[model samples]
Target: MARSTGAVGPSGCAATLTEPGAFGGSLGYAQKLSDDDPALPFTPGVDHGYLGVGLDVLGNCFGDWEHRGNGCETTSPAGTAFRIPAPGANMVTLRGPGDGTTGYCFLTATTSNFSTTGPWPSTLPGQLQGPTTSLPAGVTPAAVPSTYKFGFAASTGLFTDVHLIRNVSVHPAAALPQLNLVKQVSAASDVPLPLTPGQQVPYEYVVTNSGNTTLTDVNVTDDRVTGICCPGTTLTSGQTMTCTGTYTVTEADGLAGSVTNTALAHGTTPGGTMVDSPPSEVTLPVQRGPGLRLEKTVDEDRVYRAGDEVSYTYTVTNTGPTELTGIGVTDDRVDGITCQATTLAPGASTTCTGTYTVTQQDAERGNVINIAFARGQSGATTVESPPDTARVDVVTNRPALRIEKSVDDSRPYRVGERITYTYTVTNTGNTELSDVTVVDDRVTDVTCRATTLAPGASTTCTGTYTVTEADAVAGEITNVAVATADNGTVRSEPDQATVQVESKPCHGKDCHKPCHGKDCEPCADQRCEAY
Candidate 1:
């Protein structure tokens, strides 16, 4: 057998051999393109001593091949080669660019009118164009190659071997990274201060965040300590959410004080960022300080007579942390008044007293006397009682008197006859009379005998009646009487009386006159008529 090569150009016909055939016998191989090549026939035949074949590849046999003397004595090129007389059965193979170390991949091409410029290696099937491209899983062929080289279409050369041609290529891929943020948290500071009972005090809080990562949505929540709460809840960045809250103080054990106005401020970060600050925190402190108290004892209402003594009392205490100095109580209320007290200390107490007298003459009931108390220095600080007062009531003083007297208006008496009269005095006024005296005015014909009369008491006086011979004088004598009580009030009515005097007969003559109608006569009956 002899070997020869033949050549074919872009058109269908084979080119005539200009050089002589070097080897003997018809050594021919037809166009054996991959199944994807449009120029390769699905069903091939032999014509003009050239033959076609279809081949399936299991490995990279194309890169490793050699020629033997029985076929052609030729140095091998770096591609697949074969014998000139084609076998009854054959396989065609196609490939894409890849690494030899990793694995192998196959490509599929479409069958269509073979044109070099035709669309090939497309995503669709049946169109003819370029070389085969790699087919991933489930992919159909794109376009097929238009002109594939047939081995027989070569010149009859001494070293004749068919070379199979293929092509391959490669590229790479890309990526990106990620980012995140964290949160913050915080804790509280200290305790709070104390205030007087029923009094109020303001408290403060210091808040912060402590967590692992930077926080995104930062918010503050408040847990109100009963009876204590923040004036506002929301806070701006870096702004102190001051809780302007108050606590009303109440009495507790005097030794151990009570606590109030305790609250918590908690912070939160919204996103899932790592917490640079603590996840949870409290911003407020426990409150503590000295306690205070006040107590009063005296009742400002009282009554006392003029020149009478009145006393009042007061007590003060220190119920807190610090001591109280110069604690004092005073009442400069009424005239003739005085007050005093000393000092008080923390958790200690003291009492004081004051004395006063109602001295004014007209000081009446319900009059006010004021009193007050001080707590700091001797003369400086103090708190006063409401209506600051002491009430007073007083009594009255004066004297009064009344009197009566009786006397005889008419009297028949001798010239030296004795007579008596009496008088009485009484005190009907409210006050008792002291050092009282009574006096009687003497009559011209009568004489005064007794003098003093007690209040509601009586006294008598006597006068003398004389019968001196009244031969030359007329009939009778009259006299007047008068009396005075308290040496000032006088009582005497019609102050005089009539008196008669009759002389006894001297030398058998009648001296007493009886209702004298016509005087000095001797009455005689017919029998004893004598004149």
Candidate 2:
């Protein structure tokens, strides 16, 4: 039998056996031949043997061998033969069946054999004979041959053809570290459409380690804000961390119409190499100017009498992209209403109050209407609120009246004497009285200079009457008067005055004489000269 020899490469390398010869030379396998013949000569009376590979050294050959095929007429193994590289010392052993017994050969070489040159060691290191082995002081398993193969044959109870082989090389691991960062800005609260100054905005920085290596001492920072420190000092591959930052809006930000921020992340690799993530950025919009709105309301919508007090409330609001200052409120038809809040923030409101006394003119008009206005200043601009209006209805009250009548003359009145009667009308109710008239039952042509009387006001009307014979005969006269207002629909209670009428008494004796006929004679005496 013949086996081939070739270079021993690294672990995981493959070698093939076609026509057999001494296979792996690096594993110290040598062929023995009689007369240098190329082909194997089989004797019919002999039993052929199987060929196998082992990892061992000299007389200390150990472990089960990987059999390649049944021997004799050369059988081929499936796939390529391979060697598994371990953490420490490694060697090769060649085995074959010889005359009902097993024969072995061992070889040793340096762990790493990039180039094939070999005078294989005959004895295995004591370390290779044990269940576990450690490499020589200066050798590393990662740099060693990963695969090896050897072949040998036995015939007639004697071992013969042997060979060793190896395959390709493998390298050590590499170092790599990478980082990525992104930033975003958002409003902290319900902000007006346009951004406002003095508002708080939040910034977020997302840091990610996307490389195969772990990163240490990771830190994040923002251009617009400071003290943006990450939670963790280290980041692993495919892991992420978040950092926070904040900024207060400024006047310049508002004027520019927007605010911008940038963020960056940095970290160090295990190998002590520092790296930075790509810069990230975010932008927030600023609001334009201050806006104002006004609303007006009243405590009572309707008043039943003049001089009634009413309260008005005015609400002023700042509906703005920014804060408003020096806000003021005014009403076109009302007095004393104002704004309680001099400054207002976006989406904030405040109220103030005023009072008005219902006037007679207001009651006459039936309704009191008021309109309010609000104004504010934002930056250098002034803003006005939309007009708001409120209305109060006035109800009219009827006037009440009382009347008094009197006469200037005493109870006894002679015929043809003049008597004067007077009437007084007073308004006791809440409203004014107009078109007032006073009438006396005993006389005509009575008039008053004052025709209109206000609440709690009075008017005097006088008339004169001449006493008549009928009045004298009765010895008393009575007169009645009435006070009426507003076309006589309202009237005061009727009042009356009575006066007595009598003839003058006859003086001395003349007063006692009674003449029976017309034209009686004059008395001769002084007291009765007509007798």
Each prediction's whole-model lDDT (CA): 0.32, 0.56
Give a tens-digit lDDT track for model 1, residues 392-500: 3232321244444454646555545554544344443323344344343433333223244333343444444444445113346554455443455533342454556
Best by lDDT: 2
What TM-score goes with each of the models? 0.25, 0.30
Local distance difference test, candidate 1: 0.32
- Model 1 misplaced stretches (Cα beyond 4 Å): 1-250, 253-336, 344-380, 395-398, 404-427, 431-433, 442-531
* Candidate 1 residue-wise lDDT at 529: 18
TM-score of 1: 0.25
